[model samples]
Target: MEEQFYLVWPPVLLLLLSLGRRRRTLVLGLSTVVVAASAASWLSYRTPSGGSTPDVYFSPVLGVVPLATGCVLALLLDDERCRSFASGLAGHLGTWAGAAAVVGVQFWIGDDWTDHAWTFGLLMPATGLAAAVLIGGLVSVRTPVSVALSWSPVAWFGRRVSYSAYLWHPLVIALLGTFAIGWFGNVWLFAAAVIVSIGAAYAIEVPVEKLRARVREARRLVAEDHAARSAAAS
Candidate 1:
C-alpha cells in the first residue's frame, strides 16, 4: 500500500507531460532518460553488502523509473509496427509459452534479487519489457487468447472491480491476519481476500456510479430545457 502511494505521483507527472502532439516520442524519450539515470545512480552508490536502502523498487523518487518505463512501453504499443512485432512474437511462440517465459524468469530471479544493484538495474527494465510485449501482444491480435480476455464476464468484472480489489485487498489480508486465519495456508487467505474485496467493491462502487449517472442525467435535462426556452424566445 505504501508502494501504491509512491506510485501515484509518477504517473500523474507522466500524464501531465504526455499532453499534446508528438506525445509518444516525448514520453518514450523522457522515460528512457529517467530510467537510465535511476539505474546509473543505483550503480554509483551500490555496495557489495546489499541492503534495501535507496532501493529503486520502493523509493518514492526512484520508483518513478519503472512507472515511466511502463508509460514508454504503452506509448510504443500505440505504434502499428510495435504492436505488430508484439503480436508476431506472441503468435510465433504461442500465448502460453510467452506467458510462461515471463513468469518463469521472474520466479527464477526471485524477489530478493532486487536487493543487489546489478540485478535491479538490469533485470527490472528487462522484465518490464517482456511483460509489456506479452500483454500488448495478447490484446493486439484476434487469437483465442485475445478472445478469452475480451469475453464480457471476465473483462467487465475486471474493469468494475480491479481498482476496488487493489484498494481493499490489503485491508482484507490484514483483517484475516488479525483473526489468525492465515495459519491454514496462503491459498485460502488469497481466496478469502479476493472474495471479500470484490464483494466490498461492488457494494460501494455500484451505488456511487448509479448516483453519478443520475446527476449527469439531471444536468443534461436542465441544459436541454434552458436551450428550448432560449430557442422559443428567439
Candidate 2:
C-alpha cells in the first residue's frame, strides 16, 4: 500500500498542478495527503522489516515540502492582502503547533527522549521552522539587543561543550559504577560530569578556538599584504 502511494503521488501531484483555477486548494490538499501518507508509513513500520533504521528524509519531506508548497501557493495568489493573510495564518499554525508539540514531548519524556534519536531527528526541522517563525515575529519590532538578550542563554549552552559532556559522561558514570560507588547517583554523576566539562571547555576548547582565530587572522593579513604590494606595482 505504501509503495503504491509512493509511486502514485508524483502523478497525482502533476495532475493537481494542471488544475489552474483550484491550484492553491489542490496543492495544499495534495501536500496534506502526502504528509498523511508519509506519517502512516512511519507509524505502521516494523523493526524487523527495516523500518527501525533512521530515516534522514523524514524532515525534508514532512517539514520542508509543506513549507515550500505554502510559499508557492502564496506567490501564485500574488495579491498582497491574500498573501499576508495566508502567510499569517500558516505561520501561526505551523510555528505555534510545531513548537508546542516538540516542547510538550520533551517535557513529557525528559532525558529518555534522547534514546529515541530517530524520532527527535524527524521532529527537529519542524521545530526549527517553528522557532524561526516565532523568533521572527518577536524580533520584527525589537532591537537586536533585545533579541540577543532573549536568546543568549540558549545560544551559549548550544555553542558550549555540553555535547562533550553528554558524550563522555556516560563512560565516566559507568566507570564509577564499576567501582561500586553507591554515592554516584544521577545527581552526583551529573554534577561531576558538568564540572569536568566546564574545566575541559576552559582548558582545551577555548584555547583551540583562539588558536584557530589567530591563524585565520594571520592568513588574512598575509593576503592583504600581497594584495597591497600587487596594487603598488600596478
Write the residue-wise lDDT of candidate 1 on 1-234 in tens digits. Answer: 346746775675568666754766666676776677567746654543454444445554455555666667667777777667766655535455556667788569854674577565666656665666566657666677668768998897678867877888788767775554444766777777778878877799888999999999999999999999999999
- Native-to-model Cα distance after best TM-score fit, residue 62 in candidate 2, in Å: 13
Task: Score residue 49 of candidate 1 by CA lDDT.
Answer: 46
**Model 1's lDDT to the true fold?**
0.67
Highest TM-score model number: 1
- Report, for every candidate in turn, its global Cα lDDT versus the true structure: 0.67, 0.55
RMSD of 1: 5.2
Which residue pairs of candidate 1 clash? none
Task: List clashing residue pairs in candidate 2.
Answer: none
Prediction 2 TM-score vs. true: 0.45
Per-residue lDDT over 110-191 for candidate 2, one digit per residue giving the tens place of the 0 to 100 score: 4333334434334543444455444433333344433554596756765786766866676676666455445447567777
Q: What is the C-alpha RMSD of each candidate to the true structure, in Å?
A: 5.2, 9.9
Q: What is the lDDT of residue 43 in candidate 1?
A: 67
Ten-residue stretch with the least lDDT total in model 1: 47-56
